[model samples]
Target: MNLSDSRRASIAWLFLCFAWGTGFVAAREGVKYAPPFLFAGLRVLGAGLLLLVICLLTKAKLPNRRQLATLLTMGAVIEGFTNICIAFAVFYLTSGMLSLMLATTPFWMVGIESLKPQGDRLSSRHTVGLAIGFTGMVGLLAPKLIGVSYNSHLLMGCLVMQGACVSISFGSLYVRHQRLGVAPFMGAAWQMISAGVIVVLVGTLRGEWVRWHFTPQVAKPFFYLLLIPSMLGYSCYVYCLPRIPLALFSLHRYINTVVTFLLGWLILGEKFGVGECFAVVVIFTGVFLVQNSSFTVSKKEPSS
Candidate 1:
């Protein structure tokens, strides 16, 4: 790519990262006017519908029966369950802290993948990375877990966020293993729609409808989540994937975490102190080690 193209891509990538980073705050603000599940469902559903239109305009191929089924299942786990957990988590944890917990997703993904019969065996480096990652987690939650702060609700929120991570990790593994032939955008659209339907149904059954309000405060953040993070951020990711290396693209994870931390502190008045900074460093260091390690086994490798 030329200098101008590179510069534009860099700017777009940073914008996407910022959008995702601020999404936590948007959701937090949105739920003040709507139930968490309902808000999540609407945001994702709006994005899905918009993307579906884009897919049609681009002539993206629709998934076949088997692919559709797989996508739906993925959506149920990743978007439905995962997003509900996240929405609930934000009620108890600050967006900055929640982002830190969510950053452990790569660790969960590695652990989950290792459980499969044909999955990668844990190498010494992987083991070390896991240990360090767990230590960082413990450090981050030490106050609550050790009865110093001892808020059961907060503890539950942390667990729920981790559950969300695990759910997404499993869904990712399924996608990796299946290697469906559908276009990425098409698959994402279908998954969002399926997840939206399920969550919206659950929210309605739980009587969130009676609680729903469409005031300006909620509407603003809701639209921001739909358009900025879910739609534009994802579209930018897809656009940049071919232009950048995977490792470089993955750096956005850490960048987003930092962005969330800053935004939460400045805008939401969320706490950020020495302890939190240390934990973030340790956790991100552990993730870096894991990513750079050669312990990951390819799916094509033969299992003995």
Candidate 2:
């Protein structure tokens, strides 16, 4: 690629990362007025519909039966289950904490991939990076660790956020393995639509839809989530995936976490004391180590 094209891709990826980073705050605000699952369902559904409209206007080819099935499965695990976990988690976890926990996704990806046939093996550097990353996680949870009996909710929230990470990592690996020939935008559209259907179904079954309310306050963040993060953010991610190395692209997670931490503090008045800040630094360092190590040895793969 030419330098100009590379620069534009970099810009797009950076914007996408920013949108994802800020989405935690948007989701946090959105759930305050609407039931979590229902809110998530609506947001994703809106984005899906918008993308489908774009695909239609552009005369994009529709996926075949097998592709549709794979996309739907990816959606269910990656977007559906992942968002539900985040929605539940934010009730007890700050947006910053949620993002920080998610930064562990690369570690999960590495560990899971190691188990796959022809997968990348963990180097000594990966081992140290993983150890450091886990240590940082422990640091983030120090307060809860000190008083575990009192912070069961926080513990559960952390666990749920980790579940989100695992789900997303698996989704990424699935995409890498499948190597679908579908257009990036088309694939994302189907995934969002499928996820929307699944979440809405779950929300209805759980009575979340019945409890949902629509008001101006909720609409603002809802639209932000739909247009900015779900639609545009993911579109940029898909566009950049084929253009960048997976390990190098994954470095965006650090930017995401830092942005989330800052936005949470600035906009939401979320607290971050010296210890928490230190933990963030530690986590970033560990993630950086992992990214650098992987860049040297990891094979390129598509991300979800």
Candidate 3:
């Protein structure tokens, strides 16, 4: 690549990291002023609309009925379940805690996958890693469970986020199973828009509309989320995916967690105590072993 092209790619990578890393913090801040469901519903809907516009401009192919049906179902699990739970979860949990909790998703995915008759058999090390991950997860929530300054709402939020992780696992597996060969961007756009509509309708029924207010405090983070992570960051992902290895691309997940934890501490003043530190190390160590044992090299997905 030429110098100018290389410079633009570098810029995109930096912004992509910044945008994705701070996403949970933005959601947490936004929902403080607006109802959680409405905040999340509108955020996804706006991003979906903008992404659809870009896809159309680029002449991405549309899905037929069967593909549309599969996409919509994936959306129900991915967007509908995950987004709703996340909105409510962040209402109670610190964004950093939420991010750390999300790092356990691969554990849940393996458990879910093992239920299938054709599932990959796990090694002794893999089984031990899963156990360790679960132990760390329980430790992370031990204060609430043990009633050491426990909060019922915070416990509930943590549970809800777990539910979201399950949703994400199932949704990812479902997408892999379908193997529909729909253009990635086009498929994501349709799924997002469909799920956005469903969530917004449900939120309206819950009277979240009455709770929503367009104050300056909310508008900044709300728009930042819609424009940055959901739209531009994803655009950057599409751009970078082909140019980089899949393993390198997936490192964004780890980067996002560390960046989010640090930013939550700096910007939101979220506590990171001795217990949290110990739990974080154990959880990631478990994750490392689990991911390493489970690793199957994947080719970079085509952006279009």
Candidate 4:
């Protein structure tokens, strides 16, 4: 709580938030050139290799069989499914919509936790807030629903994107409970390696590998993915997760939606309407309320 320590923490958090916010943009940019699966595979594989090297240099121990299984599952959920689903969703929905939908992840976490015998109980306020948040999301997305004939293609994309967030929430809960007994970097390295391999294998089987071609325009974003979001951003996440409060970290999701929307608007020329604006404010406010409801009486006090 000393001034210097608090200052260091604040700086670290700022860096992490910036990285997380920009990471979505990096992924979106990378997918434009490379096949989605290929893009995800390469970024994760490169990050995995980098972290693996670091682990070896530090003499970190490898996981046991049980831990390995858990790591693989986490990989599938967090990196594998999350990447593929969001990529597919990107084809149909704007990044802003996708990000906004994905921000419901924390509510999913709360719902899951409530199912456990020893888990945190949800207040009635939290439940009401969750409903309001979902309502706002539907409002925000209603425009996309009009005039566009429904096809399995678009429906599947929406399903995949929502599934990705659910899977990530499930995987995060597993990590929170399992206690893998390794450093964040070590755990993250294994997860990325496993997920990357899976993505590459699936992509290849789906004929994505042969379809991938490298050119200057595409290559630039690919390299940025490998270095910035994949390596640095994920490292920051893994490092910060255990240190920050769970509810506090959830705010990052909200921030990410705003960041993605603004970036998409400025950089990609995605359009935003009055409905979208109102929906964003309402949705994010509800999310904040649901997430912070338990400690509301304290006003300025941070939620643990």
Clash count per candidate? 0, 0, 0, 0
TM per candidate: 0.93, 0.91, 0.89, 0.87
Worst 10-residue lDDT window, candidate 3: 292-301
Ranking by lDDT: 2, 1, 3, 4
Question: Tell me, what's the RMSD of every candidate?
Answer: 2.3, 4.5, 5.4, 5.4
Worst 10 residues of 4 by lDDT: 294-303
- The TM-score leader among the candidates is 1
lDDT of 3: 0.81
147-265 per-residue lDDT for model 2 (tens digits): 53468788899999889989998988877767778988888888888888888888888988667878998999999999898888988888788787787788788888889989999
Which regions of candidate 1 fall more than 4 Å away from where they truly are? Answer: 1-5, 296-304
lDDT of every predicted structure (CA atoms): 0.85, 0.85, 0.81, 0.75
| True-vs-predicted CA distance for residue 139, candidate 3, Å | 2.4
Best-to-worst TM-score order: 1, 2, 3, 4
What lDDT score is found at residue 173 in candidate 3? 77
lDDT of 4 by residue, 86-181 (tens): 756766766776777777777787778777666677888888878888888777655665566435554566677778878888887876777778
What's the distance in Å from true for residue 98, model 3?
A: 1.3
Candidate 4 has what TM-score? 0.87
In terms of lDDT, model 2 sits at 0.85
242-282 per-residue lDDT for model 1 (tens digits):
77777887888898889998998888888889987898899
